[model samples]
Target: MFKRIAATAAATVLAAAGLVACGSESGENAPGEGNDTVTIKIGTTDADQQAWTAFEQKAKDEGIKLNIEKFTEYPPVNPALDEGQIEVSKFQTINYQAQYNASAGKDLRIIGSGEINILGLYWKDHSSLDGIEGEEVAVPNDPSNQGRAINVLVQAGLVTLKDGAPKLTPTPADIDAAASKVSVVAVDASQTPSAYHEGRPAVINNNWLSRAGIDPASSVAADDPNSELAEPYINVFTVRAEDVDNPIYARLVEVWHSPEVTDALNKDSGGTAVQVKRDKEELNAILDKLTEEYK
Candidate 1:
């Protein structure tokens, strides 16, 4: 197991954006007893809370106590999981998890995959290209997702990356032309949607919108997570590598795939997040490919 500091504000924001509640102790609360129950800090924001609210009720029937914790960003969950601040985290994509496992040396494993939504570029002002000719676009720094974002813009005829962008992430040096030329800016995922308010369009994940309850199809450009091109980076549940065989982890995965969870996710997300039940080999192959491709 890895040892990490209690989440710094910035780290907390990046890893599990908007997850922490005031006075909430990291991993201090238990599931059922809130005292002795193993608190699973299921990291998430708006829609996660809403859907998991129902899942938690189902878990109770099985005698498992779950504490649905909220986070705002993507960088904090692993450290929280490692420090015993949380038993598990239910956020992030396979690519993100693979990067963390490789770089942070956290030894986390994919216990299950969450039906996640796709990321789409959005600007609060126009919500379409015709409305704005020259605008600033913000993209993430991660390799695959960042590339995905840039590719989306390029596909939309927005602009192109510097041409040497690695499969994972590309730095400003990788950007050949200034963003001002294409009217786009590269920003953190957490800041993108809000940036839309200031004419800064960003590629945001579906969970972010669900948490905020923003409809992408209504006023934004969206791709499905289940699309042929997107499954490589879909969200997943992660556990300490040692816990890979834990029965509780298996139970949680089972619960997540239940019809109940499916109904809750589909209804709340407006069908953005879709449940794709895969056998272990299929998921393991996906992970292996991710390790090979993203690394």
Candidate 2:
């Protein structure tokens, strides 16, 4: 199921780029190897956010020039990194990466940790989840987020799942409709805001809140960032399996957790992103566990 979805998403990206496949060959010398300042192309969806500006300046000071490639969606960024179109990417959760690796037969490695942008249930008409009972709620159709969205409703007592539903990535199929207070309407992550505007309460990812003119702090209910459930959703920086140990990548990760970058991130997220700083080994262990479950 994941392979079919991944292949379709990849084909869409390839067609958009007007290419059959991107070259997998390493494009440049490793950073900090000689007198030349090494340039690294990093992929992300939020390139225009203030955080990247701070990150770019910090990387420059370390003799690493960064080219920020802005992606409008999540599906293409991992494929771009896999094909060597970008050297590093920082947009997906470890759970999403695990699903991608399992479905695509790729072994991308997590090099650094990033913040968990708390997934929130937003509605213009309802001040709380109590008012959303027996109504249809919108969620991201993607596997990773759809599951998280369902979990959010479950936590809010607005939905219920069948016995033995996978806790890490539950889907609508797992929902006990008879017991659930609301029926889920899965849509593209980008269209969630649209669903909300059309009068359905929606589970909007943090990235789409601003586009919908919704404030981050206005969510009726949200996942607890510090909970055990959020461990798999920790956003991360990823590189090709071969570049996992590159000093330049390590330095970039170091700079990402610095006060300047984190402060900018907090500001951009409207203080909803919880900063996470786990080591590579710990992060990889979590990914490994999730990937196995996904497979």
Candidate 3:
């Protein structure tokens, strides 16, 4: 998935180079220029792209033009937004955003919550979690999602992490391998599904599941959205901290959470994404807390 994203990122940079040319010579302008119809650039994953049709039309009705930038991976969107090439992005979970902030030392604030992607442990060779006992398993190797995969395993009673392990970013080193039932391997986030298809029990991210032709409902075990661990995984729209209160950006977020967009997201995600309604400050508070933990 990320290979495709990397290839597209190069093309996007070339095509959008001229986009930054429209504003002042200083090149510090936001996406929209001096026009009646204001254009807001939003970055997101391909799975959520279908919802842009409804969101764009809604914004058009409000005289706010929306330019939807599609990304096949999470890494590119934040930098695009940070560089002023995009106004906002909705491609990452709060924890993932926190990971980025800690690494980049940027205070990009969460403007609103969009949806929750429930990750799960899937296996092609086994029918259930118990069936994979004593076997090797694969999970994402990224900082944020690696712990998320561990959380799923803990919830499934497969393993227990060490007492002082970071709950949100626990790695293989944190796992109590002696007490665990299966050997867990850390693989690239995009490869979990393929690993599962190749006979390893893998923890798969929801976004990549559909691409691998795996049904989320068929997972041996999945995250419970109502659970405490679920909060970090809820996807959010983020913008530069200075633009958090921009009225145009606020209105664009409003369109994103509208019923039409919600329905579109549900349809596009094949019912795997759960819509979340959260205010800006509350979302920021959550992000701030997670960012501190990430650091």
Q: Which candidate is the best by TM-score?
A: 2
Per-residue C-alpha lDDT of model 3 across residues 1-295, encoded as one tens digit per residue: 1145643563355356534312223444434344445556777875346787887787777666666778887788898899988888877888888888988999998877878877889888566766677888899997778888988988888988888987766789999988888889999999898898898899998768889999777888887876777788888888998778654566666677778888888888778788877788877877888888867
Give me the displacement of residue 10 in model 1, in angstroms: 41
Query: lDDT scores for all predictions?
Result: 0.61, 0.83, 0.77
Across 1-295, the per-residue lDDT of candidate 1 in tens digits comes to: 0113421332344234323221136544333223423334455544354568667776655545676667777678778877766667777777777777667755677776777665677776564667544666777754656766765565566665565565334444555455424555667666666775565667775556655555766545655455545666666777776766554555666667667777887777776667765554466567666666544
TM-score of every candidate: 0.64, 0.80, 0.79
Top of the candidates by lDDT: 2
Query: What's each prediction's clash count?
Result: 31, 0, 0
Where does model 2 exceed 4 Å of error? 1-38, 70-76
RMSD of each: 11.0, 10.4, 9.3
Worst-scoring 10-residue span by lDDT in model 2: 18-27
Better of 1 and 3 by TM-score: 3
Residue range 114-144, candidate 2, lDDT tens digits: 8998999998877776767788999999877
Indicate the worst ten consecutive residues by lDDT in candidate 1. 1-10
